[model samples]
Target: MMSEKILEVKDLVVDLDLDLGDGRTRPVLSNVSLSVSDSEVLGIIGESGSGKTVLSRALVNWVSHPLRVSNGSILYRGQDLLTLPPARMQALRGRKIAYIGSDPGSALDPTLPIGRQIVEKLRSVEPGISTRDAAARVVQVLDAVRIPSARERFYEFPFQFSGGMMQRVMIVDALVTNPDLLVADNITQPLDVTVAAQILRLLQDLQRDFKTAILFVSSSLGVINEIAHNVLVLANGRVVENQSVGQLLSTPQHNYTKHLIADIPRIWKGGPDTAAPAPAAAAPEMEPILSVRDVDRFYATKDREKLFGKQIVQAVRGVSFDVYKGDNLGIVGESGCGKSTLSRLLSCLEAPDSGQILFKGQDIANMKAKELLTLRRGFQLLLQDPYNSIPPHLTIGRTIAEPLLIHGVPRREVHDRVTATMHEVGLSVELYDKLPVGLSAGQRQRVSIARALVLDPELLILDETLSALDQVEQSKLLALFDRLQAQRGITYIYISHDLGMVRRACNRVAVMYLGRVVELANNERTFFDPGHPYTRALLSAVPAIEDRPYKAETYLLEGEPPNPINIPPGCSFRTRCPFAFDRCATDDPRLRVRGLDDLAACHLQEINVPAE
Candidate 1:
């Protein structure tokens, strides 16, 4: 049963006006056509620079200066939206159409309560509505999106919520109006897999209950497959292929679409993108390059209720791990799961509260200032956001050379070394003097990699480094890392929430939950025979084109982890574990040997737990 058309776009052509003397305008989107029916989710898939964002903006008539719809007809319920009057278009925007962007933290007013912001948006759309009524409506919608403690949380500010909760708040804000259509632009890109799966399920529920059409935009085909009924492929701002999700996945019609599907990292299946496994027997015999022993890190924060009192946040609690030489170790978990804190500890950016971080048999906490400085030369850290990580004022060459210069490299040799490193990372030498202004995300990340490698560090810590780039760029960088590891024997520690990426790039994986390492194993054991329920939950939530080993229906966690500041007693994961028993709540589990070369923190390890 086909639903009636809610919105239709025909021969849409968008142009970007160049500021050149010749007054030339380039076509950003050409002859794009699509239609969305009522209660439909139409996914727009493309890599970065494919003009997916521009198309999303143009659909809502929100295209601003320097970008214009040169030729197009955007018809909403038989009314041409492009030619609509400004006042009417403004009225239609929030009342009939809503948009949610990727970054939810910056979307809302930080100064105001989240509920109040949504209430204001509702009142603006319906002037006659009373504030009390709007507030009630906002709370109802918040609950609909599965936000816990909807009413009390209503008064909380944006910063009070986690990344997942903030994203749900944005959805609530959009759905408060009960709009006919919603445009979600990469909303799930920044979220962890479990949260992203929850968001997908929430969208499905909203589309069914509200009968709203959604234009879900993302770079991930797995995400598109999860939520979209009909998938539309975009390439260089043009509609390359439009088909049902089944048809698109089973048999992609376009070359670009095929490439995208190929580039997606598989978890359970072997593929060209899968990371090369380390020598299994050799890893046990070789001395670990880095070792963590019962590390604990805590922070003191002022109590919100009482100014005189303080609360301690156990950021990393008794975390222990071993990184063998030449190991591509992956640390994965949801946000606030202590991955970042652990990275800081490993990189020696911060000292742990207790225990030792042994790097090549030396305790980092015991090292003196000069000793620590020399130790830092052996390791480097690469951050997530490529744009902000590198200095905008510095040229590409200079940015890469800064590390060499800081190490007191001779000035005459710095340029050659910098250029060689840049070339090794796939950056063109022609970009030597160019600032990062016009560089793409991939190029910027390449510059970041070059900068990290300029010192020839033996260890590199990537804290969500590839999360910011698109799949193609991420694939290229992974290949680059593999090449560098083969050539220079450089070791890597990837701290990220991307399970697919972890599956593809890591030889050993450590699963964290609420500031604790609940499971640690080799790549095969971790993915195929996970020892902990939390690890299975993470594997279940991973969005993929192929069949998942752990089905979400059985393993997908409902709510986010408990507040890190006030962690629960017993097993930290018992709060969300579906297989939790009485013992799980009464006694805390320790990381013990669960299988061959595998350790898990769970009571199930002591019992005969059924395998999925």
Candidate 2:
């Protein structure tokens, strides 16, 4: 039986009006057409700047000024949405058709409690809805999304939730109205693998129960394969192909589609595409460039229940790791796993409450301000958001040269060094004096890299650096990093949830869970034969084009990690571990040697037990 078409877009053409004196327009999306059937998911895949976002917006007639739809007919249940009255279209948006954007942090009202915001949305959509009933429904959906303590968190503001939880709240916002068509625009792009998997599963369940058709847009083929029933390929604003997920994967007919599929990084599969094995362990005589021992970082947050008291949040606890020179170490974990906190500590942006952080045999954690400032020149930190990292007002050359100027480099030397670094990172010298206003995401990131490299830092800590880029841009950046590493012999610490990219770049892997390193091993050992169950769960949850050794059904986690403040006793991961035993509840496991240069914190290691 053919399913009923819920939404159809015909010959959609969208153009961006350039601000030049001449009325010239650039085609953002041209001749794009697709449809979503009842309870079906239509996946749209493309690289960044491929007009996928514009197309998603146009599906619901939400394309605003500057981006005008030149020609299109958007039909929602045979009613032309494009020609609908503004009042009627506005009414249909939240009540029948909903949209969820990628950045959840900016979606919600900061001042209002998330629950109240959703309740207000519900009441606005359906004026007859009672406040009590709307609140009840909002809490119900929040619970359904596996947000812990849905009722209590109802009064919590948006700032209180993690990225994953905020995303769940946004999902609750979109689904609270029981919208017939849901447009999720790159919603899971910024999430962790485990959290993203949870969302995908949640969407599947929601689609089944609510019969809501979804127009899912993302740049990841693996993510599309997870939930999309049919795939639509878009390139520079045109639909190249549309096919079922299985057929698209096996027999993609378009060159652009094939290139996109080929760009996806493989984890378990070994081929020419996979990254080469990391350099062998540093020589025995060589000391690690960075060593973290028994590090613990804690933040004091105002106690919501008490007026004067504060709660200590253990952000990083008993974390220890060694980074040898020239090693590309990958730290993989879910959100709120203390990866960011550890990065801050490593970069000396924050000091650990306890333990030692030794850089080049010097205890950086205890270094004085002046000494620390000098030591900081040896290492630099690259953050996730390229758009915000560089100062917008400064020109590219000035941005890169600022670091050199700070260190008292000669003015002439600064200009030459910045120019050389800019060239090295593949930025055209023409952009040297240009502001970062119109640079692509990849270009902005290159500027950030050049700035970080101008100091000739030996150790570079990248915190979700490439997560914002599309696969193609990410691939380009990874290759650029590889080239820079070969020439500079720079050591990199990749703090990311992207296991595929980690597998492609890093030689050593560290699996962190709730502020602790549960598993640490070489890339081969970590990917092929993980020692910890949490590691196994993370591996299982990764979306991949190639077959994964770990299956989600067997190893996928059920919920988010326990709150760091109210961490359970014994093994912290026991609550979500499918194979957890009575011993796991009473005895806390510490990192124990599993093999040569491999360590895992799991009770099963002691009993010689294997994962079921």
Best candidate, lDDT: 2
Model 1 poorest 10 in a row by lDDT = 271-280
Q: Which ten residues in a row have the lowest lDDT in candidate 2?
A: 271-280
Per-residue lDDT for 375 in model 2?
91
Model 1 Cα displacement at 47 (Å)? 1.0
- Full-model lDDT for every candidate: 0.90, 0.92
Q: In candidate 1, how many Å is residue 208 off?
A: 0.4
Against the true structure, candidate 2 reaches a TM-score of: 0.98
Candidate 2 positional error at 46, Å: 0.4
| Each model's Cα RMSD | 1.5, 1.4
Q: In angstroms, give how far residue 266 of model 1 lies from its true place.
A: 1.6
TM-score of each: 0.98, 0.98
**lDDT tens digits by residue: candidate 2, 1-612:** 889999988998999999896989999998888888999999999999999888888887898989898997899999999899999998999899999999999888899999999999899889998999999999999998888889999999999898888999999999998899999999989999998999999999999989999999998999999999999999999999999999999999999988898888888777433665576688878899999999999999888789898888888999999999889999999999999999999999998999999999999999999998899899999999999999999999999999898889989788889989999999999998899998999999999999999999999999999999999999999989989888998999999999999999999999999999999998888888888999999999898888878899999987688889889999999999989999999899999998988999999987989765
